[model samples]
Target: MNTPEPAYTPINCDYYDRLEAWATMRTVCLLKFYDEEGKEHEVSAVIKDLYVLNKAEYLLADNGLVIRLDRLIAVNNIPVPQSC
Candidate 1:
């Protein structure tokens, strides 16, 4: 059975803007986030795209990883606020 996705916690607008800027500039960033099972992961890749799917926002990385915005812990050492 497919597991239901966790409720998306909207990120701060300023952080979202930063992500957009990075994607536009193709900047390589260190991304830290939690996976479906709540495992922490880190990767360095350029942001390729940002899109919404099924009402959840996600970012695609140059390395072909798609991460939900709510799952992100930090980008480039900048911590993502827990509250929206």
Candidate 2:
């Protein structure tokens, strides 16, 4: 089996912090994040819901997509700013 190249490096805390803001404000944008196997994925949708389970935070999109925050690489093509 061929190993997959790392598609996304870990992002900063500011990015994760903004995720809740986006969800709360219902922002629509393309979200880029990595899956458990390190494969990257993107989706164009509005932030519809967010919840935490088992100590992991997840971002739920209006289009029925869910992504874990730690795997996120970028939002709307912008790199995550440094955590404050």
Candidate 3:
């Protein structure tokens, strides 16, 4: 019998923060966050703004709607953030 090692992928919080900042500046961008069950979700929006941290989850805003970051998985590439 052979044993396998566990793989790992580091998550970059700074990258996420940059993406969030870009989105807030009206820069078109996507966001991916983890959900309660550790599910990945891709959300598309201008990433309006960073919702202040709530009691349980990292708050996010998209197209005027607020959602928890944990509920996201992967954000597809989007045009660079730009001022409207």
The candidate that achieves the highest TM-score relative to the unseen native structure:
1
Could you give candidate 3's per-residue lDDT for residues 14-58 as a string of tens digits? 655665667767766566655445565666667665544424234
Q: What C-alpha lDDT does candidate 2 achieve relative to the native structure? A: 0.73
Instruction: Give stretches of model 2 more than 4 Å off.
Output: 1-13, 81-84
lDDT of 1 by residue, 1-84 (tens): 988887878899888999999999999999999989999999999999999998889999999999999999999999998654
RMSD of each: 1.1, 4.7, 9.7
Q: What Cα-based lDDT does every candidate model obtain?
A: 0.93, 0.73, 0.51
Top candidate (lDDT) = 1
Ranking by lDDT: 1, 2, 3
Using all chains and alpha carbons, the TM-scores for the candidates as numbered come to: 0.93, 0.70, 0.46
TM accuracy, model 3: 0.46
